[model samples]
Target chain A: MTPKKVTTTSGSVTGAASSFSWSKADTIRTSVAGVIVLGLLFWAYLLSSNTETGGRASFSLLIGLALGIVFERGRFCFFCIFRDSIESRKNNGFLSVITALAVGAIGYAIVFGMYLPDTSGEYLPPGAHIGPTSWVLAIAALAFGFGMALSGACISGHLYRIGQGSLRAIPALIGALIGFGLGFITWNTLYLRAIQEAPTLWLPHYIGYAGSLAVTLAALGVIAYYLLKSNTESAPEKVSGLAVLRSKFSPATTGALVGVIGTIAYMRIEPLGVTRQLSAISRKEFEKQSLLPETINGLDTLAGCVGIVTETISNNGWLVIGFVLASFAGALSANRFKFEIPTIRNSSTALFGGVLMGWGSMTALGCTVGVLLSSTQAFAISGWVFFLFAFLGVYLGIKAKVHTL
Target chain B: MSTKKISRVVALVASVALLSSITTAPSQAIPKNDTQTLVSADWLAKNINDPKIVVLEVSAEEGLYERGHINGAIKVSWTKELVDPVNRNILSQASFQKLARKAGIDNDSTVVFYGDNNNWFAAWGAWVFNIYGLNDVRLLNGGRTKWEKDGRPLTTAVSAPALGDVVAKKADASLRAFLPEVLKVAKKQQNTALVDIRSADEFSGKIFAAPGFQELAIRAGHIPGAINIPWKTAINADGTFKSTAEVRKIYANLGIDGKKPIIVYCRIGERASHTWFLLSQVLGYDVKVYDGSWTEYGNSVGVPISNPAGTVWGIA
Candidate 1:
């Protein structure tokens, strides 16, 4: 039997039919992307018009837009990045993370020097993502990493993926809500037992900015070097001009952009975090149902995305909204937007994994973006601790072939 | 029946109108029976069941009221309820009236304010209540700490009393000082005394704010020429106010006599309200709290600042 032939728009010979009808699909998608951009602009205008949270929310939305574009174009998913390194021994994606840490650390050092010139003083930089270092943090990171492996994405990864029409993310997010409730339930005992007494070590506090920056850069340099040495993949071919918008950004480029965005975000608004709004929404719901403890037991005093029960959408909520919408636009422009139907197996696993990630993030006070990325940039030892344990958890989960489940 | 009869009627009407006017005028004096500014916990305990007494627990601590509050006390969040939800100002007169009525605060009610954290926020509540011209607002002397330490009764029960008919007056400008008024004192152009009621570190520009506080200023320092009298100086270790004579002496040593109009301030005016209460209510001095305190003064552009710590942003 002869195989059927597909015709092109120009009536030329073809094989392997296009995913969808090609004649108007591209134009429709491009138009939709344009409309999304317009929508974002209108949303920003409305946010800025609000008297209470105008400037802050607007700024956050812009930052979120930048982050969304970078994350989508670079495919900056922690789960995928770790999986490549652990399962296939491809270390290129991991290099981007190191690059981001290095760039962000430098930026943070400059900002910190300006904010708190004398690091010898007991004062910490305001709004920096510095949290107490404890066993609980380590355990939380491990769970988070394992969940990433299980659910196929981290919290941020799931958020961005939702923009690409990943249906499984919906259940996972719902599961995360339940997970946050559980975290609140267990917070009091854990806080009193360990987090209360834990040491919040800022590297600059001990060694000064010069020494801290040197240490951070040197460590990142070593990691980058190791990643380059082990990486088997060749560098991607360079693309320029208008094509750049449609093409995937190089990992280094993505990292550098993310670092710049993060620094600007920290300078203007709060630290780069995605889970604060999610956690807050969950917390508010739980409080309404009388599920949360009357007090969160020193949670407010500690930093890193403390969830407050509020009726109005916070600046962080605006940031998340911008992130999702901009990611959708990016996906659409790249022709990567596809509505993936959720299978029973994928849905169940995603939900379970999301629950673990949510519990882990809530207990740790942040996720990869908040803790590992933002905290490390600020030279908090907690960030490095989280990085190590989270990597280990991913490695173990991948070795166990949890992703197949 | 003409001019003489009309004159006689006019004279009678004038005398009656005069008598009514004299009788109906509002008195400025506090009733002789309730003159105390600082009420003892014992006094509150005895009057806990008094329908005319409304106790308000104003706390900065989250969920503190739910955990336990003084019996018959209503919870008031210093951050949420006392201030405007949108603007950086006190609650509007209309909003204050609604909150007051909801809390069963009648015009004649003797409102006693207390809270955790050494009664810093409770004093702020008292100041806000005073701003709306509540006549008989009082502070619990030792606040929650002393009460808890003395093993006084606390309950988780919430009261839902009948709505009150309290009418809120226009916010009294005399009780609250604004930035322009404070700037005059800071620039030393005005003869008023500026009392900075923050920790020594904060006053010295060594730290922006008290540790763990969310509110902050861009620059670190106190207003130029402001006297540093930490609010805690007026309180004993037991969280009760020092005797009036001692407090007077403490201020007198700093050259702040009742003669000069004093403006008290802290990071966000809560601690300053504590000092405001001490100076105006207890010591019977002319004082006002600059609600826009260090957070305002430090952040304001081109404002004169004194940083003896040699702290400059980005300069080591």
Candidate 2:
């Protein structure tokens, strides 16, 4: 990035680059965010003192904190990444996804090997929730992809965007919850039919862990090779007013880090899932009203898109809080946090997009975190299925956006 | 992936397979039958030759047992054997007696049940036997999964054990719950807990049925104030029932203390049987399997329904 020339009253010349420039405003913002973060950690620690489950919950929140920081600074929003590639033909953003998938796949394979020393059996890796492969899954993923295009962000984006004081995020979040409700209502019918008939296929089940690993890596290689080879342009230098904690990072750096962090989260507690907290909240409310059925179809002890609705503070619940707070902290550090309320048009679209994402994710048994990222890494066939349909949905959504006023 | 890329990756994996003999470690020790009501793969493996020991595979899939199952195991289809051919009710006592004799089971038989879908239908078979007062009934812990995982020998040969006398008695009220009794439990709210052993969506009446199944009910919702704890929670990762203490604690946390009489149900009662076994036989609770379940309740006209999703027919 080009540095700007700055001359203080003292007749000395100095070049100031991005993110390092300090100002009273930056310091104030950082201080406020830091205090809030420390407060949250203290609360989590306090919670942990009561039980072992509390301790795990706190650790999960810390993991989410790291995720929030990386996501905010790296601009790792899936919507923007795909949109930039499909609309502008700029491919840099795509590199991050590729790198993340590469790292995640390797890490997951290692973990799977350790867990299932005898990989030949029909055991589904615990906690992966390798959901049934069916038409329902494809349609759901397509819906989620379309929602991402419409809302300008997926579930993760909405949370982090709110950290930056984007008021449109509020509607998006609300819409997602509503969409989740809709998904829950229709889940039984789907579960009994298509989902029941659909096979829960895992790559390791047939090919062995090594074969699945090789296949996944080879696929990623082909994608990365073409992406890197064809894209000749580097990013234009970023120029911002009154920079605080902002710093430019390569997609490889952010992606690899994301993969490593996500794997670690999965290894210790559960896979990277964002909707558990939201759905849990909705489930609890329904439970109170006695509106829930005696049983839901398909969902049992599995962890994924439709997570357990619990009265107690779950690990994912705490993670949700930590993600939002840490995202704010990250934004403040980078001086990227700004309160930008959307116009009626943008907000309406975002809300609808949120609804679509929620419904699609519910049907698919996960969002980006649960399906495309985590399942893909786990070598589940649903990963490939979701990948294909979601990309198609995103591609068409982008085209539709271009055609609209 | 595109067709070309898929083929390429498949070829690469296939080539890799040729180079190395990839060993897959199947997850070990199918679920253990820890409680009195269950038997493990190891236990069943050791006892299959006993004259009194009979292993029956009752699965929703018509030909699952025929494909490859435990050696000498008999197949029992839910629709064909357990339920009435014409009505939704369970088979009559005479029908039960006939089916039991055909499978070569008698009053003294130590019949063990197992099946695919994590023993979803096998549990139902166990419940049916309980109603007919089968003295010694057990579910194979981890069911077919444990049997297969441990590398137990599976044969497709049909069994022809000698028929023994087994008379079907009156329906056992202690094990089965009727709609009126369930309604009474709801109205009274005494030391009786109605446990909905289904997934969360079914509890919420968000949808009429699961993804693959056609709608089974006219309405969607739970009985008034039923606690929604899916049946599979009682099961371990290997498809075995969890330890008694652990399982007891899970229900206890859900306010279903063993002291309280518990009524368990699922969409059509098969899944509920799994939970019923866990509560009544494993955790030692006074539990009743609601055989009518959601299908009966949701379809009933003007019955008290608590559909939180406010599900309307054909609309979520």
Candidate 3:
């Protein structure tokens, strides 16, 4: 019998150990790396802690890893999901995302209410959690949502995808920083009139975490079941569950790990943030290095989010950077390494997209993660407003055909 | 295959370990100036109680300081800080020092500053401090607005004059460039290219913040022989500058090679700052941001500018 041949872009895959035929052993090796990295993170966050605050970091990482794995498996990127739903009229990815959000919200509410009682009125850990609502936040959300469509990824998604070599991400990130700066520039006027004037919207305290969680889970269940039933063909490609666990770690998988990272991110740092942290690094470098004037640095300077202070070397900043590098390693191990740069046609789109995001993030107060995800969990009005407006922006961008896609 | 995999793993482990060790010692390294532009909140929170840590809330609005400010911070009016409240341009060093002393800033005090509406004024002030050689200065990230929002302590108390010694340190007597720098660069056209970082209006002399040309008979455009490069083009929406590679591409797109000596300028030199830092510091290029900028040249007694759009001005 003639030897059958399968061709790939870089090389061909034949019957046995073809150049591109990823093996189970290879998958195991990558997964082992992931586990070891997660283990290191656990040691850093939980095992190292001695305070009453406990090892919240480990918990955050665990949760982020689990979520990351799930999202990766589901291909649950906000950009792909939202874009597919609006432009292509495909609903599977969109449905998955909505299900993920609902599931996340339900899980969080139950955990918060059942385990950690909020009797002591301390500020909540700033994590991949939620907070109150404001006009600024609403505007930022709308812009961020629009930005997600334009840039082809949301904030955290952009972070992971960068390792996969998406050129559009660079501009999107730049735009976020500009939006932050603009936010700083206009903060005073906004605060005097809108932000301070707007009432804070609390989720758990008002609705009761348990009831809210139950409602959320139910909502997700309904949506998932409906979407799944209506669109049978949209179900994700399944290998035996064990096979999935054994697939080579690609950017999609890295994204899921990021989810776990997000969980851990919340556990340690102020909140679950990828955009702000990365942008802040750029801002710090600019001001410190004097690449931009110190005056212009106001928007993202260290004082903006965490406070008007810093140590010799920022610990959280370095740790997150380390995570990004680790993610890069994961990407490299999978033989998928490329830098994503924009073409001329897409460059203009990027510039405009950046401009919108900059202005929008400023007005919104934060992006998808900060406003939408965090606020939704926190049960803030602006979070909901952001979600609605952002969805509208994404839809409009898709319909108008004003995007690179 | 196994050998390659082992090598890759070893390389990865070595690189990670190396980076982790290097990152342990974070540098306090910053730009060369009279003072540094930004500071962290952690720094502010720790030194909030220090008397010498004078925080100034400089904003456009007059009574913004009385509403809320850092515990001992005083409100310094931006209009009054350097402007004549008439010229809207660079203030005399003497006048600037007077305002500085009034704001409780001394020659020796480690000033940590911020202001309303994005802390631009504070940054501007920091820039000024650096020019004057006041070594200890930093900007608070997120500024006063964030501090107040986080429910960090804010006070409404305001203080008056405590005249302190403001020692004059003019390191480079020729720091404030006249028409020569532009003229020489334009005339020789050697390794130099003028980068107009000012707004289009200022470049065209449409809205005059400072007198650009008074002595030379130049038109209303950029330098007689230079490029019209806006500073904002270099920044992303997040108020962050583009990466080194991105910036390199931008310069290349403009046909201004990075290897060339680039001089950046704007209406009053404020906007040019972004480009100045980006090129010289970030990209490690041979460049200078003309802080005196267009305001000095456009309305100068008799300098020149290019009139028609897309026309380069050439001095006779």
Best lDDT among the predictions, by candidate number: 1
Model 1, residue A148: C-alpha shift (Å) = 0.5
Please identify model 3 stretches exceeding 4 Å from their true place. A1-20, A23-74, A114-130, A218-226, A229-233, A240-270, A282-319, A333-335, A339-341, B1-316
Cα miss at A390, model 1 (Å)? 1.0
Clashing pairs in 1: none
Per-residue lDDT of candidate 3, residues A246-276 (tens digit): 3343322333333343333343344444444
TM-score of chain B of each: 0.88, 0.86, 0.62
| lDDT (CA) per prediction | 0.83, 0.78, 0.54
lDDT of 2 by residue, B1-316 (tens): 7764664466457545544432321112222233656777877776665555678998765335654678878878787679997987889999899989978786767788999888988988998998898877888989887777677888756666566587778888788998988888777745579999888998898878876666889898799879999877888777888877887788899899887788998888888998888788676678898889989988888678898998798654
Ranking by DockQ: 2, 1, 3
Q: In DockQ, how does model 3 score against the reference complex?
A: 0.01
Best by TM-score: 1
- DockQ-wise, the better of 1 and 3 is 1
Worst 10 residues of 2 chain A by lDDT: A1-10
DockQ of 2: 0.03
What TM-score does each of the candidates earn? 0.58, 0.56, 0.45
lDDT score, residue B183, model 2? 81
Query: TM-score: which is higher, 1 or 3?
Result: 1
- Residue range B255-315, candidate 3, lDDT tens digits: 7666777777766565564455556544656666566566566656655556545432352
What TM-score does chain A of model 2 get? 0.90
> Lowest-lDDT window of 10 residues in candidate 1 chain B?
B24-33
